[model samples]
Target: MNRLTLVHLTFLSVGKPPAAVEFSPGLTVIYGASDTGKSYIEESVDYMLGASELKSIPEDEGYSSILLGLRVDDGRTLTLCRALGSDTIEVFSGDLRDVPTQPAEATLKYRHHPKSKSNISRYLLNVMGIDGRRILQNSRGDVVPLNFRDLARLAIVNDTRMADKRSPVLGSWMPQNETKEKSVFKLLLSGQEEPVRPTAPSNLQKQVGKGKIDLIDQLLDETRERLSVEANQTQLRDQLGRLQATLANATAAAGQVAAERSAVVRRRRELEAADADTQQRASEVQQLLSRFDLLRQQYESDLARLQMVGEAGTILGYFQTGTCVFCGAEPQHQHPGHRLGESTQLAAAVAAETRKTTELHHDLISMIEDLESQAASLHEDHARHTEQLEGNDQELQTLDQRLEPLNTDTAELLETRSRLERELALHAQIDQLEDLKASLSAAPPAPPVAKADGIPAADIADFEQVMSQTLEAWQVPGDNRVTYDPTTAELAVDGRPRKSRGRGMRSVIHAAFAVSLARRNQARGFIHPGFVVLDSPVLTYRRPEDNKEEDELLAYDVVKNFYSDLLDNSAGQVIVIENGTPPKSVRDRAAVYAFSVDGSTRQGFFPPLDSSW
Candidate 1:
């Protein structure tokens, strides 16, 4: 089987300054302090392999792009460059310097896409001598094209996962992915791919129908909670009809009351307008009467004064004095300036004033009488209008009293009608759900069977034996014999659960399990990517947990013997990332890189701050 191996991983700054590390074919160890880039090495390798996103770190500040060089077993070199936060990787035929402006081949998609030829997973899988392969995802026999990322968990183990208790075969913590994950692992172990068979259109239609049935079932359950009555569509419709008829009757009765109230209100408005006009007329009549009374008094006073003048003139005429009584002269003796004719002139003037005053007195009396009559008529009209308004107000109060009960009844009817309509709608929904359910039942697709027939029993036994031997070689205490539990997809050591052990023991066992699988693949001619990267595999030595004295010895023995075993067997390539110091025996055999924070040799994975991007 063709296999791929990492040659180098480079982080290029904007100026193309490089922070890179080279790897050998066999065991490679990167041991360093807490904040060093030991774990980042594992992450970068994954990112280059097609991880969705790169972890942002302070050490990554200067890096604008990542370049990974890979060498195939056939001696061909491939370099892939991906800019930060980008999903497209430029592929080159050979390793080159300074980010290439154009790739030699078409760009590869970072994530797998349906029906895409340029996805990185397909590219990498093709290079690994596997193509056109499909894995059974579910048992209605749905198969999906193999994806590299699903297999990456087995190839690369990160630090936090070192403490996880779930089976390493499980990709995510979600329950739904467990079956697919186990299936993929089994396929890798058995070296067989399920045949691709296209589903018929009828089968697809059945599946879609089933999905709709499920959705309608869920909707019916929700609608059931809101239904006021438990009844079928027929019964509910009958009840709706009755309620609607009742509502119509109630509406008509209420409308009649409303019309009557409206008529009463309109009549009240008309009476109010008439009363206003009558009041205005009464005001004008009162003003006219007041003026007429004043004129009548003036006319009477003038008439009285004129009558006195008339009497004085009559007396003067009866006396008939030819000359002024004081002068005592005859008519001939009266001078032009004398008052002999003054009395006659005064009588005449008085007579003319009296005649004019008498006429005015009669006219004023007549006008005053007419004004008094008009004022009386206005008073009568005002009284009549006031009575009419009072009657209208009483009628309005009666209408209001009648409408109050009608409004309450109508409100209750409307609320009942609305509730009945809602129930009717729910009935319609239930009917729809029933119809969908029946349709689905009539043309049901095969149910998805549980994925139980996992890896072959003989293959599992061989895997168990390999795991047991690997752990025994690592000097892990207790019965090192392991068994793979198909149900849990986890390993059982010494008849005890792997997760039941201490965290440190779990980490050690997890690493052994990973390395053993890779070794077994190479030995048994199984399909594998030919490389595994483990971060913090031997954490027991770093932390004094789970029997310190015993763990220290085991950790030392495992670290010392682990590398020797891999190198001695020419096992698949492995990268072990750890914080604990490496054993002298292992250090001598493995390519080692030690990192620190004090600006010593190999300060960190990043370039100097001033030289960074």
Candidate 2:
């Protein structure tokens, strides 16, 4: 187990002398004569721990405040200080002074003032170790806002007042079980009360049962719907069969129609081919006739021109003086030779023209004759083409007539089948719906179970076992005086009768309980805030002050045994501030640390010097 030394401590009441001091392990005793500020040392520890309200010092006492310096086991130092004017508690490290809260450097450096941040509280109460704060709170009051659940989980605690306070053994577990009444004490500090559960009988289960039956019904209905679908399957197949039969008949009729149409088309095509041939011949004959007409017209014009021009013989015989067309006989020198030459030439030209014209006439006559014969043949072909075209037209009309009824029948049959299929599908769906309705009418029920308790058995063992070891270390022996009661939720202790037990016995029992609680704290083995600060206990020295030997010795024994218990718990600190420091016989066997408050101050007022302002 590790220990924490009070590096420094200072006490100040408002407008009074402040006290400053330091601490070490084993024992730290502040020896202050009458009017000395010895109690300031104890008060300083309290202020640092969590005594929130300011304690005022008298006018003569310099300052009314407190300051403390703690050196933790891991070498981290913390400074806790409070002054008269300060509205808040402050902490720091080294030269860094007047800190808002504990420094968060390390676990060793953790120094919590009364008004610490919530996270720091959680760290202390939930994570650091077992929490003493909640248990402390049970004895204390509403000092801060915190999570009590987390606090209780961290540690359990006992204070110097344990001996004076009543035991928690009776009715402690009453609040623990879900069985009975809850306790206010448990609620305030720990937020842990009696477990609770609904007392009402459930009606929702019946509704759920009915709902499940309905769901099953729905499922059955769906199955019946499936069966309906199966039933319709045969009808649909039969309808399909009928449709197939109708389709087969229609297909046969259509096939016959197609065959007849094909035959008609073939005959029509043959007729069309004949018509085309006749039309082509007629066109050729018409073209020949047109050419013959042009050629005859040219020949007639050429013959007319030939008739207008007389021959050379007519010119010689009918010369009659004008004469000499060959040579202007009378008016000019008429050359008979020239005339004869001209006549001969003219005669030859006339004969040539006459021959060409005669050949053209013969060609025209032959063409006209050929045109007449071809026209006669073309007229016959045209008559045949007209007859064939009329026949093809009638055949095409007949084919159209033959296929129309088959197309209509196919359309009507297909439409009727589609309608029947839609009706069957609707009927099948309705049948399924009816089955679903039946299943909803009949439902079933369910079974029951129980809940278990969940308090951790491991924690109970640790809390109980650790306290036992701590008690033994404190040298406080007993015959199974204390026992844990989960039902009542406390550790019950049976003490010897007050008069018969004597002061020694009572002190031993309570001191054992306190030490046990301190040791049981996991944080005490590692990091701790401070020593266990006990209030004044003077039950042993109740005899006359004048009886120096027996009374003095007995009083000495009380503090001596108390101090011895503290020394045994050397892993941490313990402060038992009692009235009247004890004498030699009890002191010889133990170690003691002494501190002096040199300042002159009155009782109930802060001291001057030896502390701080």
Candidate 3:
């Protein structure tokens, strides 16, 4: 940031307001004894420059406005004003000799209201191009400094917590919170802050930063007390529910089994009744077969006798059988012409007997056929009955197999129902246990707000740039290294950033931060409104003279280098409202624009010390 040279300003004015205070690019001081409107002037600048808050004035100072005669980077002259009530402020670009007034292209307002106190480090932020946390107050007078400062450690305010000093919490580094913000700031400036920070996970997030457990035993005790009864109940309940559902399925299956069993029993009884009919058919078929076999033997005998008679007739016809033609007398049964003798008669009788026997054989054959036909019909009926019996037996076997499982299933179903009921009971018990446990246990606590994105931490980019440039201003060794720790959120040198809690250490750190920023402005031009109107920084000195000399020297070098750097830098203006002398080098190089408290104007007005435009 460029060192400021105040040219003109008026807070409580009568005629037209001192609408402009053209600032110089070099050293500018608005020094005063107690309250010569020095702080008010700073507040005026802040009001015009978009401070979230501003000081309220009495009704006498209507529509507070500031006007300035300014020099451009191109060596041109212009007039600028900040009008509180006007729709737009006026701007003149040319020479003071022939000024032309026109409305400014843009109208900027303070981020804070025009009734709040401004912090010193905030001015530094504005100069380095940072927006310090502008706390908004509530009706109850509670301040919620811009929510961006969740972590207080990130806010480095005064000389008490300089960046160069070793931090106490971190023996070899700065704080983690600050470094994180710094990294973010750097990224934001570079347009890369959006990509950082972990993405939210898909799984249920385990509540972080909850349930206090200061000691290991306390944690164990809490877990044990909370989970013991609930765990057991939950398990039992789950088991019971499962068993009940299983049992329901089993009962349904068993009912189907019982229906099948009834069908099997009815079929078995029918098969037993058909057995007697099958036996009767078998006995009739056997008697007919026996008679047929005896008839077949008798038929064979008759056939043999018929054959013998036929042979005898043929012989008798050929031989004249009147007398004993082969000793044949009258045939035994014939008496004609030597008639058929006893032999012929006996042959006739034998033929008749044979015929009868042949008839009997045929009858036997007919009887056998009838018996066979009857047997076949009965066998068919028996076969049908046997088939029915086999079917019934098979069904019975199947039923027997299913019956056992069916009964078992029915029993299981009952058990399952009981189990389900038990499970429900257990579940209820578990729920009660959980409630009791929760009631007995303390509620989880919220985490402390982390200090990040505020002036101190957010200033990391400015802080680092300033410090690095400061060292460069001092021109330290080429190997002088620097790194920022994200975890501890501190800037580490040679790879370590320690948190400083000691008085000297903190002072040095703060001093380093201021010098670094001041030196950076001295070396490079970066316009930021966070830094401006740094009237005085609040300090907390822990010791009489701890690291005081080192801090002073660091301060001097930084201020001197900043002045030297401002010759070309145009980032923004820094108005250091100081009570002591500045370094010699700073005095020799830059123009001094001061606000003498005992001026003709009681409130002290702006005018160049050398009276040069």
TM-score order of candidates, top first: 1, 2, 3
For every model shown, what is its TM-score relative to the native structure? 0.58, 0.41, 0.35
lDDT value, residue 158 of candidate 2: 26
**Model 1 off-target regions past 4 Å?**
196-453, 540-554, 597-600, 610-613
Please give the TM-score that candidate 2 achieves against the real structure. 0.41
Error of 3 at 598 (Å): 8.7
Q: Which of 1 and 3 is the better model by lDDT? A: 1
Error of 3 at 151 (Å): 19
lDDT of each candidate versus the true structure: 0.77, 0.49, 0.46
| Local accuracy of candidate 1 as per-residue lDDT tens digits, 1-613 | 6788888888887664688888778988887666667788899899988898887988788579888888888889989888888988878888755677664586888988648879888888888877667777765557787788877888899977876798887768987777678878888778877655454335677688768888877888998988877777688678778877887887888788789889988988887888788788878878887887888888788878877876775565456557655346786887764553665677678778878877887887888788788878878887887888888888888888887887887788778778877888877777878887887677544454646346788888988998898888877788898988887898779988878987878887788888888889888878778888989887633431222223343456776777677678666788888766666677678788867622237766776666644
Off by over 4 Å in 3: 1-20, 57-63, 67-184, 188-193, 196-483, 491-534, 537-573, 583-588, 595-613
TM-score, predicted candidate 3 vs. hidden true structure: 0.35
Candidate 3 C-alpha lDDT tens digits along 366-480: 8888888888887888888888888888887887787797687778767656655654554565555555556435444323333332333444555555555544544333332
Candidate 3 weakest lDDT stretch, 10 residues: 147-156
Clashes of 1: 0
lDDT preference between candidates 2 and 3, better one: 2
